[model samples]
Target: MTAVPTISSPAHLSSPDGKTAMTHTPLRIGLIGAGGISHSHLRHLLTLGADVYVYSEAGAAELVALYGGTVVDSLDELLAAVDFVDVATPTFTHHALVKRALEAGKHVISEKPLARTDAEVDELAGLADELGLMLFPAHVVRFFPEYVLLKEAVASGRLGDLAVLRFSRSGAFPTRTPWFADRALSGGIIMDQMIHDIDIARWVAGPVERVSAVSSHAGDATTPVEAAHVLLTHSSGAISHIAGIWGPSHLPFTTEYSVTGTEGSLAHSSVAERNYISHLASTDAPSGLLPEVDPAENPYFAELREFTDAFGGGAAPRVSAAEGAEAVRLANAALLSLETGQPVDIESPSAQATGK
Candidate 1:
């Protein structure tokens, strides 16, 4: 969740007496990068009633026009004005922006892969700890209801001991900003896209022991590698496979999750233009659920609410900095495995060894 202030704006429609009747906490929010993902952040921030102060190289006017707020021209201005900051910039720049914001004594909600390297992640984690401030990584899938249900089901032994888990995610290429295709900026699709599933694999199955994978670039693009298939082995004796690609059409995006266990198997999918959750009690009978999807409401708000709650209560974030680091670790290992034709150890400290 973005830590933006609420703006109760009645200024344009106020009485001629120069008085406006509205109330707002006025969270000074400094948002970096106005990209596609940033729009979701902006919308959710507005919905959450935050004082939206946008910061982007361009598109400031458009954002302000739509969201009814001002856009600060300089990062310094943003730092001085905002209570907290949200970094939605290119992946390579996230660490520097977050580091600067935290150094300025402001709370931060960073977009992902806290840094390209574990060393950088460790540095940021240590700094946040020293400042006694909040630094939460954006792992929005954890907030999705389906994911929540799956986690609960697994934890409660409803699915028995896990035997296998498989995830399939694909979609058409996003009309993204140019930075997205640059491998240096985005770390390719493995980190940019499939990392979400990698995190999910660990979250539901337990710590991953090793990973093996294969990858390819987006056609002839020189930037971020675009597609991947990864295999994961968990410490709990669970074997999992994940596939991500960017060639689907006729559907905006699709995801399928299947977990097989000693007692039963549960499958959930956001394909066929429907989201379904089903369970096979035995080889013979099956039961399923279809939860209603409400328009204009989502788990992202809840994710933000949880972040603020943790900050206010002096508790750890639901998804800690360490977890984000580990996600990056897994991504790095998978890339290593893909390049070297071998299983990469998740706990390996040296990049050379992991990539071997």
Candidate 2:
């Protein structure tokens, strides 16, 4: 059986007096970037009954037409009008856009990686702190019910002392956008794709002391890399093997995780025909990040709702801006390990790394 803890939001809302209120007030949400990921967020925001405002260089009008939202003419207009901004733009643009939104006194929910570099993340974090605003990285996997259950189980000691864990995430290599291949922009596979598992690893296995990685990528930052594997040595002595791949266009997206402890184990696979509840078991499944989610149970929806409540002066969300910085730091550490061919020590570091 799973330990089902209720971490969902309360009925709290933002009051005109600038305090938490139980009465729901209309929240004006500004969505920047009309990419595919933005579509997911827009749908969820609508489901949450938010008044949506969208802005983008391209596709904003089209997206608003297909979905429901009023397209804004400029980023400044969107910033000025909304309570918060959801940044679903390309990897390289997150920091600047998030900073601009924060400076505008709007809270932020940024897509993953948060930013490309540690310095960028630090600047955003500091700005948010100075402004006394919240910046959440939409690490949606944390909102996935399966993952939430696993995390609760771990915390409950149902599986006893965690001994080892394995996580795998894969998806079709994002070729629609050239930025996905540019290591400087996307941080290659580690920061863009693998960072999902990296964040989860830290969440479940606790803080990491060090990291080592190997990649199939050869040549420079712009070179297209297909796959990479990372090893995380957690502070509590548990080890995790995380694999990320950008496979063929025909490759089905999949994700699976196995957590083992002294007393028992639990596992789940997206491609499974059927899954048991008791122990870790599977019968040959296709796996990676962004698994098939029922429309009603979309993790993206759950994630955004939580952030939306927090934006409404509710409780803080699960993934904080500092933790977002840490994810970038750890991903950079793995990238550094690839560069130097040695394990990178994070125990005594200032989030500096030699790679993207």
The TM-score that candidate 2 achieves is 0.85
For model 2, residues 1-356, the per-residue Cα lDDT tens digits are: 12222222235767889998774456788999998888899987877878889999999999989889999999988988888789999999998899888888988999998999989998998899899988999888888888899888888889998889999887766776888887888898999888988988888768788899998853343333388989998877899899987765445677889999998999988768643232223323343224688666677777887788776657777888888888899999999999999999887433322111
- Give the top-scoring candidate (lDDT): 2
TM-score (all chains, Cα) for each model: 0.80, 0.85
- For candidate 2, the 10 contiguous residues with the lowest summed lDDT are 1-10
Whole-model alpha-carbon lDDT for candidate 1:
0.72
Model 1, residue 133: distance off in Å is 1.5
Q: What digit string (tens of lDDT, one per residue) describes model 1 on residues 1-356?
A: 33444333223346568886554354557788787667767877766567668888888778767766668988899899887888887788888899999999988888887777667777887788899877888987787777788888888899999999998776544434566565566766678778888888888887888899997765443222257899999877899899987642222356789999998888888755543222112222221111233344466666665665554443555587767878887888887787799998766322211100
Instruction: Evaluate model 1: give its TM-score.
Output: 0.80
Task: List per-prediction Cα lDDT, in the order shown.
Answer: 0.72, 0.81
Query: Ten residues in a row with the worst lDDT in model 1?
Result: 280-289
